[model samples]
Target: MSGRRTTHEDAHDPAPTWTPRLGDLAHDSSADRTGVVVEVPGDGVFSYHLRPERGGADPEWTAPADGSTLSPADD
Candidate 1:
């Protein structure tokens, strides 16, 4: 038999969560801008690059706290 043994904790462990992907819509209340997720990368902190829904030159980078005002955009 294999050497590994199972435990109750292991069985009850939650699965890994997921993050947003490119093309997903998000909003920044502080900036009052709605945009699509252009890129997801770490720049010292976990941040998202967003392309403005109203059209812009370059995507803006923002690091929104876990329970902050940032939220999914309706469009």
Candidate 2:
């Protein structure tokens, strides 16, 4: 194989280096998951699986940061 690495799919690729109020997120409590776009990876992938915003807390009940997205609760 070539030295070049295969890139991650772009459709789901998250942008890197969010400038605070910079990242957009999707949450799935049912899936017990959350994610954020970060730049260090440079793969257009989430920096890491987002754990609860705080240790052992329910992030869903938490308020978002200023300018952060707050989708209408569908539950």
Q: What TM-score would candidate 2 get against the native?
A: 0.21
RMSD per candidate (Å) reads 6.2, 11.7
15-48 per-residue lDDT for model 1 (tens digits): 4444556777877677787787776665564666
Stretches off by above 4 angstroms in model 2 are: 1-25, 33-41, 44-48, 57-75
Candidate 2's residue-wise lDDT over 1-75, tens digit each? 767654667546554432322243545344445533222222553333333433365443222332133322232
TM match of model 1 to true structure: 0.50
Q: Backbone collision count in every prediction?
A: 0, 1
Q: State model 1's lDDT.
A: 0.66
Worst 10 residues of 1 by lDDT: 61-70
Error of 2 at 25 (Å): 5.6
